[model samples]
Target: MRKLAVIVALTATVFLASSCRAETVCPAIAQASVVALTVAPEYVSSVKSIHLKACQDGRCMGADLDLVPGSTPIDQGCEPGSYGGDGVCSATSSPDGTLTGMLMLESLTASLIEVTVTGTGAAGQPLPVRALAFTPRVAYPYGEQCGSFITAGVVLDANGLRQAA
Candidate 1:
């Protein structure tokens, strides 16, 4: 009985020591307040130029965003030389004519923000202005220990602007 107790105690000690040395390793990734914008597919080809203006806590920023072909991720293994791959799988973009852009901000503190989206068509004809007053969401995407980040999204469609779900 004494030998069994000593063995158990030694096992417990080794287990505790090993666990103490275990750590949560995180990647060295930079964080930012990025607002992703997606133009509806039906209007993607029509919108040749996009201008975005966002305001929060009395500070406002405006700039023209360069729209690019949008893609969604696939669970299949990544192909060679694919951008933003997880080393296991890559994103796939179909030629569906969907264009997307990003509106980066120095920081977004206020819960509520005002946004204005304006653009021109392929012929320089102005598209209808889309505006929205919505709140951004805060998330700890990497984990709570990694800290929180504020993210916002907007959609521009024939119906106008609306916050992303």
Candidate 2:
């Protein structure tokens, strides 16, 4: 009886430790607020394409998000489509040449990285931008529950945090 209890406790301890560690590992999160690509004098455009990558934890995922001229629902792509329907993020461009994009970010484990802009500038010229200024939405004090649900914003009761500059 004593031997059996020892083995059970050891197994439980290992499992719990592993689970907690997995829950704590955070990925990178960086969002692009303004995007401007000026390849040359003739190539000067306000909007092009947006790309975001979640990098870290031996994982890397990116998508060619859509760019619009105004604010819209980020969940618009919850449906199904290819060109004009499905996308990861929605960007709003200002007349002064500011691009503000939003991604709800289901899981906020530090993942919003690698912003790339690729598209044609004015006069139908190729303009690819791999570097731009990005601002990471200030991460809040977060905790997960059962490793699937979070004890934070949605289900968890905690005062939400504000964005960092």
The candidate maximizing lDDT is 1
Model 2: how far residue 128 lies from native, Å: 3.6
Q: Which candidate number has the best TM-score?
A: 1
The Cα local distance difference test for each model comes to 0.83, 0.38
Error of 2 at 114 (Å): 3.6
Q: Write the per-residue lDDT of candidate 1 for residues 1-165, one digit (tens) a residue.
A: 999999999999999999888577666787677778898788787788999999988888888998988766555565555565444554565565568898888887648999999889889999888899999988777888776777788988888998987
lDDT of 1 at 81: 52
Clashes of each: 0, 8
Clashes of 2: 8
Q: What TM-score does candidate 1 reach?
A: 0.72
Instruction: Tell me how far candidate 1 lies from the true structure as C-alpha RMSD in angstroms.
Output: 6.1
Candidate 1 residue 30 Cα shift, in angstroms, is 1.4
lDDT for residue 69 in candidate 2, whole number 0-100: 39
Model 2 TM-score, all chains together? 0.32
Off by over 4 Å in 1: 1-23, 77-96
RMSD (Cα, Å) for all candidates, in order, is 6.1, 15.3
lDDT at 40, model 1: 79
